[model samples]
Target: MTRLIVAAGGGGDAVAAAMLHAALYGDDERAVILTYAWDRLLVDPLPGPRGPHDFTGLEPLTRSVLSVPPQARPIPPADSTLPRLAAELPHTLALLDPHHGAQGITRQLEELVDHLTPRSVDLLDVGGDILAGGDEPTLKSPLADALTLAACAQTNTPVRLLIAGPGLDGEIPPDDLRPLLGPHIHTFTTADTTSIAAVLDWHPSEATAMLTATARGIRGTCEVRDAGLPVSLTDEGPTVHEVDLDNALDRNTLARSVMTTTTLTEAEAYSREICGFSEIDYERDKAARLKQQPPAKPDLASVLFRLDEFQAEARARGVTHTTLRRLSEVLRLGGSRRDELRSLMVSARPEQYVAPLWRIA
Candidate 1:
C-alpha cells in the first residue's frame, strides 16, 4: 500500500513525521510525506512549500520538484528544514504549496492518493494542538495543521490520526490535552532516549526536539518559542496515540472550523482572528525584511552573550544540539562573529557540521 504521512503543522513536522513513521511502521518504501514551510521566522527564514508565487517552474512527480530562487541565499533564503531533509530523505519529501489552503490541499491529496494508490494514509501531529477544542488559551500556529486535517477529512482516504508528545508544542498544556484524547486513543510506541536517539541523528528536527528531550529524560518547565509563559513539555515524552479522523475532528472545534475552510487564506484569516494577534503577519513581514535588509554586521560581545543564554537554556532543558544557523541568527552573528560562531558549532559537533552555519537541525 502506498502510505502517505502528513505532518499536521509545519515547523519541523516534516522531520517529526519521519521519526514517528520509523517508530510506528518501521521502514516502508511506499511511504511519502506532506508538509508546509511555516517555521520560526527568526529561527529559520526559508520559504516553505512553494506557493504559486514560488513556482518559477513546476514539474509534478511522485515527489514533485518546483523551481526556487537562483541563489536563494543572501536575500530571501530558501527554507532551511526541507533542503536539509532532501539531503537525507530525498524521496520521502512532498511539499504542500501554501498559496492554497484546505480545498486546494484536498484536491492535491486526492490526486496524490490516486497516483500513489496507497492502502492507508496516516496524518501525523507531533504535538497535539491539532486536536485542540479551539478554546485553549495558548493555541498558536493551528492554521497549518487544521488546514491539512480539514483537507484530508474531505477525502474518502482511511486516515489514521496519530498525535505524539501531547502539549509538546508549548501551545496546549498537558492538562488540557487529556480530556480531548477521549476513548479512541491507542499507544503504539514509547520512546525513552535509547529507542529514538538515532531518529534525530539523521533528521534533527525542532518540531520533534521537545519530544526528543522529553523521551531523553528532561523534566520541569521548558521554554518553547518564547511563549511568554512556561510550556509544560518537560513531563511525559510522548505516546503515539491513534484515532479516527472523524473522532479527532469531533474533539477539536478549531479542526472542525478548519475542515470547513475552503482555502489557506480563509483558514489563516480565521485563526488570526481567533488568536487576537497578527503574529503570522508580523513573522511574514519580519522574514521579508530579513531578505530585503539583512541585519547589519553583528557585534561579537553581544552575540556571545546571546549564545551563552541559548546554550544555558538548552542545557537546562536537555536539548541535545543546536544548528549553527539558528545560533548565529539568534546571536545576530555577522562578519567576524559569524566565523567565531562557526568555530563554536564545529567544536560541539564537528563530525556533522555543514558550512554557512548549517547544523544537523
Candidate 2:
C-alpha cells in the first residue's frame, strides 16, 4: 500500500531512515511520501512542481515535472492542518493577542477552514503540547497535537505528531502517542553515547538495523547524510525504486501505482542470509557500531546476499553458478523461504531441517 509518513522537521533524518527502510524491504511496490510540516507553515507555495513536494501542496520554486498544486494540497476532508502553536509562540501571540486581534487573522484562519471543508478538506492542529510554551494565553484551545489526534477518529486516515531534530526534552507525548505513532516515529538524539546497541534499544525495530556515522569514530554526534548501516544481506538498505518524491504527495495516485509494481524476487533470499548473520554476529558486532567504535569485521552480509540472490535468479533463468564458491553457496541456501531458510542454515540440529522446495517441488 502507498503509505504516508509525515515528519515535523524539514531536516528529519528519522523520516529518511523510514524512507530508506521502505525503499529496501516494503511489500508490493512502495514510495516514501515525505512532508516537511514546519516548512509548510512558513514558506509560500512555489509556482509549479510535481512529485512529492518538500511541503504538501507547495510546489518547488521552479516548474515541476508533473502537474500539482501551489499551496499545500489539503487532503480535502481527510487533510488535517497541524498548527505550530506550540512551536510558533511569537506568531500565535500576534494572532491571538488583543492588540493584533484587529487583523482578524484568527477569524481568517477559521474562515479558511470553513472554505476548505466545503472542498472536503480539513485543517487540524497536529503536534505536541510542549510547543505550546505552557503559557495559558498560548493554550487558548486544546493543544494542536491533541486536537489532531482527536480529529483522526473522525477521518479515514491516521494522524500523528511529527517531531523533528535532536532536542526532545520537554515535548508532551500523546496520551495515545504509541497508538497514533504505530511504529512511525523516528528518534535522533545526542545523548545515545554508550553504543549503537543502546541507541537502537529505543527504536521499535530493536536495532535490527544500526544507524551509524560513516566515519566510524564519532560518538553521539552522527550526521544524517553520513549515517551508515551494517549490511544485513536484506533489501532494507536503501530505496530500490526511483521515486521523484514530488508525485507521491497525493495519497490516491501513489496508492494505485504501488498496487501494480513488481517486487524484487531476490528479497526473500537476501532477508534469509541477513537474518542468519544477524544472529551469528549479534553478540560481537551489534554493540561495537553503537559506541562509534569500529568492529573487527565489516558486516556486508546484506550486500553479499543481494549478489547471491541475483546470481541464483540468473541460474534459474538458465544462467550458471559454476565458479568457486557459487555452487556451494546455492547448496547452503536450498530455497527462498526467509524465516525457514534461516533456521535451516543456523539451527543447532541441521539434520532435522527440511527445505520447503523439497515439499513443494
Candidate 3:
C-alpha cells in the first residue's frame, strides 16, 4: 500500500513517524514523510514558520504538477532543525508551513495525493499531547499538532491519527492521556524500540530521546529543554495508539476550534483565546529580542555560570534539563564555539550529566 505520513508536530515527530512507518508498514519505500519548519523556539529562534524563503529547489516543483516544492533554502541553510537533519536520514522529506494553516495543509495533502497517489495517510504525533483537550495546564505547544489534526480530519483520504510515546513531550501528563487512549493504545515491539533508539543517536530530539529512555526502563532524574525544569520519565514503555480520524475534529477542543480556520493568523488567534496560549507570539518576541542584541562572546565561565543557574532553578521546580545550545542562545552567546566548550567541560566534570544540549550542566 502507498503510505504518506505527515509529522504532525514537527521536530522529532517526523523522525518518529518514519520509525512507525518502517515498523507498521515493513518498508519505508512506499512512504512519503511530510513535516513543518517550526521547532522549539529554544532551538530555532525564527519569528514565524518558514516557507518558500527558508527552503530551496521548489521553483521547479512549483512548476511540475505543483508537486509540493521543497520549502528549504540551501544558501544560508534552513534554521529549522528537521531539514538539516533530513540529509543524514533515509526518508523523503516534504515541507509544510503553518503560515498556511489547515487550509494550506489540506491542499498540500491533495497535491501530494496527486503526486504519489498514496493509499493511506497517517498523521503522526510522537507524544500523546495531540490527544490533549487544550485546557490542560501542562500543554505547552498545542497549536502545531492541533492544526495538522484539524486539517487531516477534513481530508478525503483515509487518514489515521497515530500518537506514540505517551507523555514523552512532557506537555500532557500521562494521566490526562491514558483515559482517552485506554481502548485505543497498543504496545511497541522490541524491534520498534530498538529502531527508535538507533535514531536517537542520529537525531537529537528531547521528546523522542526521553521516550526511548523510558522504553529502556530508564528512571530517575534527567535533563530537558527547559532550564528551570527537569522532566522525569517513568519506567513505562511507550504506547502507540490509533485514533479514529473521522471524529478527530469533534474529539479534541483545539482541533474543533481550528477546523474552519483558513489562515495561520486565525488559527493562531484561536489558540491564544481558546487554548490560553500563543506559541507564535512567544517565538516572535524571543527572536526579536535576540536580533536586537549583539551576541555575547562564548566563554567557559559564563556558560558554566548559566548552567549552574539552569540546574538550580530546574531542581527547585522539579523539571528536567534544558538544551545547552538553546541555553547558549538564551545567554545571547554564539554557537560556533559551543563544541569547543563542550569538549573542555566533558573532561572537567566526569560526574556532570550531559544530554547533548538537553542536559542539566
Which predicted model would earn the best lDDT? 3
Error of 1 at 312 (Å): 7.9
Q: What is the lDDT for 261 in model 2? A: 20
TM-score of each: 0.74, 0.23, 0.81
Report clashes for each candidate as comma-separated counts. Answer: 5, 23, 15
Q: For model 1, how big is the CA root-mean-square deviation?
A: 5.8
Best by TM-score: 3
Ranking by TM-score: 3, 1, 2
lDDT (Cα, tens digit) per residue for candidate 1, span 1-361: 6568877887367666666666656654536777765555533454334353432233454343231222222224433345545445524566676456576778778878878887678888877888866667776666677778788899867787877877777667777677656344333233433433443443334447667655654444543343323445444445666666887777665556666566556776777666554346666765676678565455555655665677667666655444433554566552224345555655654663422113222
Q: In model 3, which runs have C-alpha deviations exceeding 4 angstroms? A: 27-30, 59-78, 182-204, 292-298, 301-361
The runs of at least 3 residues in candidate 1 whose Cα sits more than 4 Å from the true structure, single-residue gaps closed, are: 28-30, 42-49, 52-59, 62-80, 182-205, 227-229, 233-235, 260-262, 288-302, 307-330, 333-361
| Weakest lDDT window of 10 consecutive positions for candidate 2 | 89-98
Mind sharing the TM-score for model 3?
0.81
Worst 10 residues of 3 by lDDT: 60-69
